[model samples]
Target: MNTDRLIAVLAADAAPVGPHVVEWRIASALSIAACGAVALLLLSYGVRADLAALVATPIFWAKLAFALTMAGAALVATARLSRPGVAVGRVWAALVVPAAIALPVALVVLWLAPRDARAALLLGNTWRTCSLNIALLSVPGLIAILAVVRSLAPTRLHLAGAMAGLFAGAIGTAAYCLRCPETSVPFWATWYLLGIAIPTLVGALVAKKALRW
Candidate 1:
């Protein structure tokens, strides 16, 4: 067969892509996963009893801000990775900014506190279970987002998987804030980071196989 003839034949039946298809699909998948995470939180842990009081506090908002900002950043990175040749560039800064801000604030708070009281700030009441719970909440999002990525054309499989996992973990962390009574910045800087890391590491480890084309 003539090469030009074959190329023309292949192009003849190609369909034009609809606008915002990738964005719509990924957003829809993550929305469903967020709902799942919320439901899991309600069923398993319930909201913090003093939520009404906590709602008026600045620290509560700060915790939510950090988690959600990280989520938004991870979503952008994962979306870029989903395509074949898109440049990721500085999208990672979004992921770092929240943590970067939180860490310095945490250190400052720790430095100002009495030495004996430092442990209480770093290890909140639920430290043992917090990371595990956040990782558990991430499962639904991980499965959902990974499925979305698998259907797309991600070339950088490991990075894509890690970003997806981070997105899931960040959203899960935000949901967890409702049930978590820890009011200390140091605690969030430590345990919440561990929670997010759990899934991110998992994604990197599994990506080569899970994201295989």
Candidate 2:
């Protein structure tokens, strides 16, 4: 086949290229930060307790850090996929590696702890509360992220999986709030993290494959 025809065929098989990577990254970062800000605001103005202590705690900060890091990593993968000549399979693999390592480690750590300690770890503090708060704060932020991703990425595969994962996380968080009593940081730091972060990471990985053109 001629060069033009060959190139066209290859392009046809590739994922739809959407927005500039940098812009998407910035938008995602801003959305996450906004969520955190809203969470803090709710804690201060709406909730009964002292926001200062909750925000200051190492556990709360750690959860924030983890969420931000995962979001950042997903954005990076998305950006990398925007470049020409990157394989979809390779991008998916890149996204999965860290997650595979982290998931097992998190599970093992939780499993190894004594039963009472584990329960205490998962149910003791403001995890459920913060998760509910975070989930509530996340709704608008997540919607914004979806809109940005749709506008920029526009690929059906990426959009569908990402939105599904996001919706699932939001719903799960809501469910946890209804059923669970404890709302501590450790509770969210464990089960809640797996619930939201895992799906999000999976969505990002899928997006890398499906959105690439």
lDDT minimum window of 10 residues, candidate 2: 171-180
Q: Which regions of candidate 1 are displaced past 4 Å?
A: 5-13
- The estimated TM-scores of all candidates read 0.95, 0.50
RMSD vs true structure, all candidates: 1.4, 8.1
Maximum-TM-score candidate = 1
Clashes of each: 0, 12
Candidate 2's C-alpha lDDT?
A: 0.50
For residues 125-172, could you state the per-residue lDDT of candidate 1 as single tens digits? 989999999999998999898888877879999999998899999989
lDDT of 2 by residue, 19-56 (tens): 56556554564556465445544554354345465666
Best by lDDT: 1
Distance from true location, Cα of 117 in model 2, Å: 3.4
